[model samples]
Target chain A: MRLLTALGQDIRFQFRHGFYYAYLVLTILYILSLRLLPESLVYPALIIILFTDICALGFFFIGAIVLLERGQNLTQSLFVTPLRLHEYLLAKILSFLLLSIVSAFLIMLGGSVGGQDLLWFIFGAIFSALIYTLFGLVFAARARHVNDYFVKSLGIGLLISLPILAYLGLFDTPLFYIFPTRATLILLDTLGGDYALSEKLYSVANLLIWFTILSAWVYQRFDRYVRHPV
Target chain B: MIRVTKLHFAYGSNSKDTLNGLNFHIDSGEVFGFLGPSGAGKSTTQKILIGILNNYRGTVFVNGLDLQKLTSDFYESIGVAFETPNLYTKFTALENLDFFAQFYAGETRNPNELLEAVGLKDAANTRVSDFSKGMKVRLNFCRSLLNNPKLIFLDEPTAGLDPVNLRKMETLILAEKARGNTICITTHDMHVADTLCDRVAFIVDGEVSLIDSPRQLKLQHGERFVDVEYRDGDSLKTKSIPMDKLGSNDTFQDILKNHYMETIHSREASLEDVFVKTTGRSLQ
Candidate 1:
């Protein structure tokens, strides 16, 4: 219940800070691109847009919000509350993921992607959101300002997007499966009925394992951030 | 309600200690004040007690539990109001309060009532970004009391407030004391320390120089006399009479009986004066 309250507050804060509106605008843009672009280019555009915007955008989005909270010294108040770091992190991830989901769903819905693929798309979007949000926190903890935050986040963002190599045909080996973004790409590809069931299961399992590891890292990073905040 | 022993803290690996070997204890229901000049470790000490800074080498027992061992539950019983206003600027005053009030599973005060108490009733619906510094301070104070905490840590609680709001805040703090809540106030404002704190500790250079009740300190260091001002014809005359024998002193008696008295005031030292005398540093 407390988590829900915190989530509600976070969502409200995000909306008031223009994150919600930003997502709405992104959704409209995605819809327009799908409608205006050639059919053959639409799928690739959808993959790139969904992957980059939904999964990767959270790193910078959450970074911006964290920096704002730090500037206002709201984190000091939050640190003193009964709300633990995990609960706080969960609230942030869930809130930002809600925006990611909205954008992903609107794009996929407009693209006429449905059935099991849509469900996989939703799952992939959520996992990607969670991963990048946590990834953002690691850099946000060390960043002193928004400009520095974007710089650091951009570097980390590229590291997380290393899985894009598999999609671009630069690397096709199974070693790419280690990257969470690779899992997301595979999920999207499978959703489009281009991959076998066994491969889809492998991608889901790999993503889950990465999520578990990132979750632990995020928890510790958040703890350190709270204890000795920059 | 709070005890610290050999408290030592430094900001980084090679930095000097910000708080060095500090030791003090605050009794339950007591309004204890941590007084110091800027960079004197008053805020660092408060932050430790409030569980915001834990990288210190010390055993801090708040409400009978060691701070190092405390979980998030420790915050359920404590309230903290920072010197600067830390609030959601985009939210309305009431929304900010209500949102923070949800953090605790325990009972919380009504948001509207808390705002009204702080004289922010009219601005309940107004976004905090539009509030003045004084209004934001009051709203921050209101947020601290939301959980009805047993222990409250106020860092310069009355800073940026007008005289009227200062008085209101003092009343609210005293009321909290009356309700048996222990409060620890950190401030360089001598007037606030003298007015609200039952006992105050003077800190200098990350160490405690003196700790005593304000009244006791004043009486101990102040002159044991009363300054009597009276009108002699059209001119004013003043005499300092020893308080020990004022009732029997013939000169004092004669002056009281034969002179038109203007004012008689006890020669008591202000907290600021005692602070300077004790710590050799002003509370600037």
Candidate 2:
């Protein structure tokens, strides 16, 4: 019940602060861009677009939200309440997930993309957004300002995107599986077409494992750097 | 309602402790103030009591619960107004209060009533970003009371208020105290400490030097004399008379009978004076 209340407030906060409106414009642009692509290129382009923009929107947006809250000293007021750290984090992730899922669904619909496994697409969207959101939180905790967050996140962003090279078959390696984005790309590829059952299981297992690891790490960093900074 | 013994804290491993062996207790329904300058461990101590920073090497008990063992429910009974106005600028004043009111499991005060009490009723629908510093301070104060908390922690509660608003905040604080709430205020404003606190602790160098009622502190530190300013034939003159025998003193009687007395004042030390004398440091 407490989590739901916090989530409601978070959603209201985002709505009032223009986050939903900004995403509305961005999502429409993505749908239009997808429609302009050739029918043969639409599926791959949509996958790439979803993986880069919608799934990763949480990464950039959560950083901005956290940093803005920090700058305004809102965290001090927030953590003082009965709301636990995990609930706060979950609300943030879920709120951003709402935006990501809505945008991804609209883009897919507008592009007339179909014949994909809906469950895999949902899982792909959720897990990918969760991973990136948690990753963003880790950096946001350490960032002193919005500019600092972006500069540091840009470096982390490039490192995480190295899996794209492996996805494009330019630098394929088993080592790429270590990055959560690798699992995200594999899961998102299911949206374009069916894959081997073993590959799907591997992708699911990889994302689940990464989610567990990142959850613990994100909790620790947020507790240390954001909640109880020395 | 609150107790601390040998409370010690430091920001980092290599740094010296910011709070050093502080001991104090606030009875329920008492208004306690932590009076100190910046970096004097006043805020550090309040943070510890409020469960914000818990890595302290001492024992703290609030409302009979150990600070370390406290859970989220502990917050339900406590409200804190931070030194800075840490509110959402994007939300309207009423919206901010309503948003925070949802966090409490128990009953909460009406947001409109709180806004009205803080003189923000007319601006309830205004976004906080449009609020001046004083207005934000008032709104921040209103949020702290939404839970109708039993124990309240106010940090520099009068930092940005004009005279009129400052008096309003003070009256509201006294009203809360009248309702039997224990309020712990941390501030360097001696006037506020004097006016609001039942007892204040003069904290300097991370240690409390004195803890007593403002009236008692003044009596103990102030000179036992009264100053009289009288107008002579051509000029004004002043005389200091010991307060102990003022009625029997011939000079005081003569001044009142022979000269037009302009003004008379008891030489009672202000809280600022007592703070300086006790802590050996200015509030600045």
Candidate 3:
């Protein structure tokens, strides 16, 4: 009940500032521009932006929430209950993931084009958003301040995505199969069947494996790392 | 009922224990007080009991369950209010109560009724971040009772309030006792300890030096002399007579019978004096 109230407060805070709305409007404008480009590029660009936008927003918002809660001493009050660390982490993830998906879909709605298959887009978005939410929790657990989160989030995201980026940019190889985010991107692009059965299974399996590990790591480290000095 | 035996606890990698070989118990239906200074282990012990701190040595059993084991429904039966006023400052007083009120499985109580109990109904809608220290203290006090818990742990429960509010808090705590809850109060205010506690343990340097009722301890250590005052003709005089001889002494009886006796009473030691004597440290 308390977690729900806090999440409600977080939602209200999102609307209280003009900058929050501006950020959404700008993203919606970017999505509209993609619709005007070549038809061949629209699906791929939307797929990339879909996964990228959700992951970026997930990390950004979750990081800010964790750092701000610590600053406000809300973290201290939470532990006074029987609220296990895992429950607290789950509540935070769910609240942020719901907002991310809602806001992302809202932005995408302002534009006409989305993807080849709505089901594939929704699946890829939800799955990738969850993983990123867990990843952001792991990120925010260590970041003490918002600016530190900004610097460190870019560094960490780059560090994790580098293996695939380097393969794509420097070597020009098909090593997009290595990073989980790119795997999700490929899955989104292959929606409505332009790919083989085995390829689809492998793509989903790859994402599931990485998602499982990241989720476990989030649960294990979140409470164990951050706690009142009881 | 609560029982602790050979309880030893230490901070991370510290050479000495915060609490070293401490032992105590409280029977059912009694208000237990733990009095200690800032660095003493009062809060540490309460944390261990409330299942906040693990890695403890020895055993603690609260209401017959092992302290280390975390259970789903135990929260419904217990409540804790920390000394630091750990409240969500961004939420209003009503919202703060509403949030924490969800963890318990018991019947929910109205936040307005609870605020009224703590003298905070008018400020229910005001943001806690805007509240004064005393207002937060009242909110913290009210938060501890939201679940209508059977066992409540309060650290400095009456901190940062005016005298009238302090008295109201005292009455509120005793009222909880009337409802058959076992309360553990931790504070250095001997007056609070003396007034509210049925049995108080004077803890110092991580160990309980003495535990007893305030009246009993005062009787045990008080001076056995009564100050007797009387009016002799136009002059008033006072004298201290040994209480043991008051029954047989001729002059003591004559003063009480013949002259206008003003006042006569025995001196009783206060809880503060007992704390100072037993621990050799001032409660202040």
The most accurate candidate by lDDT is 2
Best-to-worst DockQ order: 2, 1, 3
Per-residue C-alpha lDDT of model 3 across residues A1-230, encoded as one tens digit per residue: 64665566556545452435766776767677776779776655665566566545677678887776776656756666656666777676666567667766765675555555666556666777777777778878778788888787777676555433432345434565656776566566665337666766776787889888988887766655566353
lDDT of each residue in B120-230, candidate 1, tens digit only: 999999999999999999999999999999999899999888888899999999999999999999988988999999999999999998999999999999999999999
Ranking of predictions according to lDDT = 2, 1, 3
Report the lDDT tens digits of candidate 2 across residue range A1-230. 77898888889889988988998898888888878878888888887888888889888888889988888888889888888889988999899898898888888788788654777767877999988888899898878877888888879987987898877778988888788788778778877666888888888998999899999999999888777666
For model 2, give the RMSD to the true fold.
1.5
Off by over 4 Å in 1: A115-119, A170-175, A227-230
In the order shown, the candidates' DockQ scores are 0.70, 0.76, 0.40
Clashing residue pairs for model 2: none
TM-score of chain B of 1: 0.97
Interface RMSD for each of the candidates: 1.5, 1.2, 3.2
Candidate 2, B87-167: lDDT as tens digits: 988889998998888889999999999999989999999999999999999999999998999999999999989999999
* Candidate 2 vs. true structure, TM-score: 0.97
Winner by DockQ between candidate 3 and candidate 2 = 2
lDDT of 1 at B201: 96
Chain A vs. true chain A, TM-score per candidate? 0.91, 0.95, 0.80
Best by TM-score: 2
> Which of candidates 1 and 3 is the stronger one according to lDDT?
1
TM-score preference between candidates 1 and 2, better one:
2
* Top candidate (DockQ): 2
